[model samples]
Target: MSPFWITAFLDFSADGFDDGLRFWSALTTYDVSPRRGKVGEFATLVPRDGDAFLRVQRLRDGEDRIHLDLHVSDPRSAADRAVGLGATEVADFADDGYVVMRSPGGFELCFVDHPAGVRPAPTAWPGGHSSLADQVCIDIPASSYDSERAFWRDLTGWEQRESSVSPEFSSLVRPEGQPVRLLLQRLGEQSGTVRAHLDWATTDRPAETDRHVAVGATVQEVREHWTVLTDPLGRRYCITDRDPETGVPPKPPTD
Candidate 1:
């Protein structure tokens, strides 16, 4: 069965944990929940309007990366299905209600048995602008792209569609009411495991970009509709010109 809720977890090193938390909290205008877990390694960004779908993880080891947590009805069963579809089980924390795994392309994620139904609305700011961190784009190398895409397609049972914006991109259609959507980007020929980055849909891209820059994000590049920036912890994300409420890019002008 497909997950009912999806959360984007931003993993950060021990030394950079607070900085990452502060940066993301400011960006999303969400309150940071008290640290949880045995070693206080996990925290959630609590939205004011609905269930939160963004979290921060303080890593004990490994480089910082973005990962997903699929909230399902049963963690063990979901993990089993994922394994059958080519995911590698990394750890079985069934007692804790989740199982960690890596996809065929080496992107780490977890199947979690957590109930969260209401999706959050966009965060409003001064000057009548709004934004929401709504998508996670998985960067896949060409060598692993096809199989990787198939694995996620089978796992999520979501419609797969090529992106109208670019040939190099395709997306796993988000079910109605899901908090986060998955996007797969086919990268040029390279040798490496897949990685993930977050995306923000904004009503006013220029204003949202400026707000993010005010909070220490450095501009990396500006595309036609999206502006790339590196967070204080140096993770890459984008401010996209998509409707904050619907997460869709605006239609082009007709003559």
Candidate 2:
């Protein structure tokens, strides 16, 4: 198995970079790393107490979206494996140790070569909320749900299972040491495109939502165990009812 360090990225338009950086930093309680890249458009969010697993990019053009970066030991091998699993190559940077591809469902994924390291521990904030940005939920049309799920499972070599809380949700379970998990959510109707949003595992959903709202996010809706909030950049993310320390949903009690 090719070891992977899954990093979630928030890509924003050049015009939205400042606002995006400020909002995400406050929400996640992470400090912005010094800008890098030729145009100073890339940076990582540094956590106070753990390894960082989230980054921000300022795109020259295009709508803001979230994408995953897979840091592996061999970029070519991983990219080839992803291609065999129904992902198409979007760009290649072998010399630079990275390649970009689009998965079967059209979500952007990047494979990069990096040394294997320990997974970052989860972050807990004051007021009983935790921030993991550890899961990316792909919103797909009903027609593409099964195929998309199969594609991700084969691509990442991660276990795929239906969510216990909802039939429409399927989870791509990461390996024991992996930092990120993939979740596929079937929309009620066909959506125009397959897009991804970050999911934060929080111990307290209501308190987390309120914390985000205090930092410029607004509640879009409240579900049974999660609250969806739109960030200052208008991107939607969920504060879920999962343990902050383990990133697991509470287990059902045996009768």
Candidate 3:
């Protein structure tokens, strides 16, 4: 049940839908595609360089969060495999061509048969830095960390790469042509539902952070290697000091 392509969705509540769409498009340098769902609740962030992978969804009611849409050949079989792996079916829209399921740790995701696409290039900014929203970090509570991490690895059939610099983080090796990568982080808490957030790999964190602030993101926290910011709609994401072309964090200074 491996997916051939992956998409990251920034889902916002109805009250903040318009603002969320505008904020994301500006930050990621993508244009909003025409809305598609019955109530016009779904749209893709179309990049000028390649096939679209980032998307936005307007939720009727609920807090804004990041979720994944796995593009598979068989949605039904994929849903079944996920359920067998401790996931629960949330909704089935077979006729509409998708299925929604919540993982054991309660992270929501969808299985669809969207077409495979070429990966988009990192957007070059006026500040001479490139940035790519190429990763989704899944925050898992300590109690369910192992299970949740294993589930994603098995589901994606991607090799798990443990972070050398941080014991709490691990990531799935992204296959060629896949737009977004999956990262799993163990939270300090004992137990709770899993949550996800977007991560931008940038050549210059400071410049990217400044650009984001100028557009509308509020600095939430400035970490050693990553800066957390809240979007215009108050949704949280991070800008990391990573090579935009490779998604690799900078090595620490040698002793």
Candidate 4:
């Protein structure tokens, strides 16, 4: 009875005006959120289990687009809708026919779908998504089995895995090597600032950020790419769409 975790991406809108607008529109239908005094901000539809969808746009020297992919119930239909909304087609692979696309603002995303069984849902947070197609799981670091299991159960509302993964590792809702999990084990102490962190892809950016702070995540300084954030347990992560190098996605496996 551990709480579920959902994860998604945020387009760091460091591109130009038109480009930034394009990405925002494609995700949330062109409704860009106006900043207090800054240029603008906007977000996409949040996926189930994920906490937020972040948006980043550099004022000058906009960086590269972070490539990312998400699973959905329907691939063909999702591709059509994304194209209709202005998602640029980059390319497609065989497995899920990952429709490589770039948003209006140069941030990269894939309206991915494949001929596979129904994908499992993600861990739901306070400001998480409400969509069925966009849901996926997230793995977190837990110190002990009892504490880890208790925290997730009280927070995410996800179930536990029946099979044993390892003495230290325990599966949350999803299976081993699946989209979501919780790594409950002991680790060393911290050193300096984290090299990477979770960039929150949220519905209401500032509002969701506030909620994150309330949940025990310490708000770190915002970098040129995106905001630097730490989870309740002090784990670092980023919430961005365009990763200067590989974004936040894992490198594809080779045969």
Which is better, 2 or 3, measured by TM-score? 3
lDDT against the true structure, per candidate, is 0.92, 0.83, 0.91, 0.39
Clashing pairs in model 1, backbone N/Cα/C closer than 3 A: none
Candidate 4 runs further than 4 Å off:
1-66, 94-96, 114-197, 200-255
Worst 10 residues of 1 by lDDT: 240-249
Model 2 lDDT at residue 21: 94
Which digits, one per residue and each the tens of the lDDT, describe model 1 over residues 106-169?
Answer: 9999999888999999988987999999999999998899999999999999999998899999
- TM-score of every candidate: 0.98, 0.94, 0.96, 0.27
lDDT of 3: 0.91
Best prediction by lDDT = 1
User: In terms of TM-score, which candidate is strongest?
Assistant: 1
Tell me each candidate's RMSD, in Å, in order. 0.9, 1.7, 1.2, 18.5
lDDT of 2 by residue, 1-255 (tens): 355678889999889999999999987788899999999999999876656678999999999999888888888888888888888999989779999999887889899875545667776676655667778888888878888888877777778888999999989767777767788899888755678898888777777777889999989999997888888779888989887666679997799
Against the hidden true structure, what lDDT does model 1 obtain? Answer: 0.92
Each model's total of backbone clashes: 0, 0, 0, 41
lDDT for position 124 in model 1? 87
Query: Which parts of model 2 have CA positions greater than 4 angstroms off?
Result: 253-255
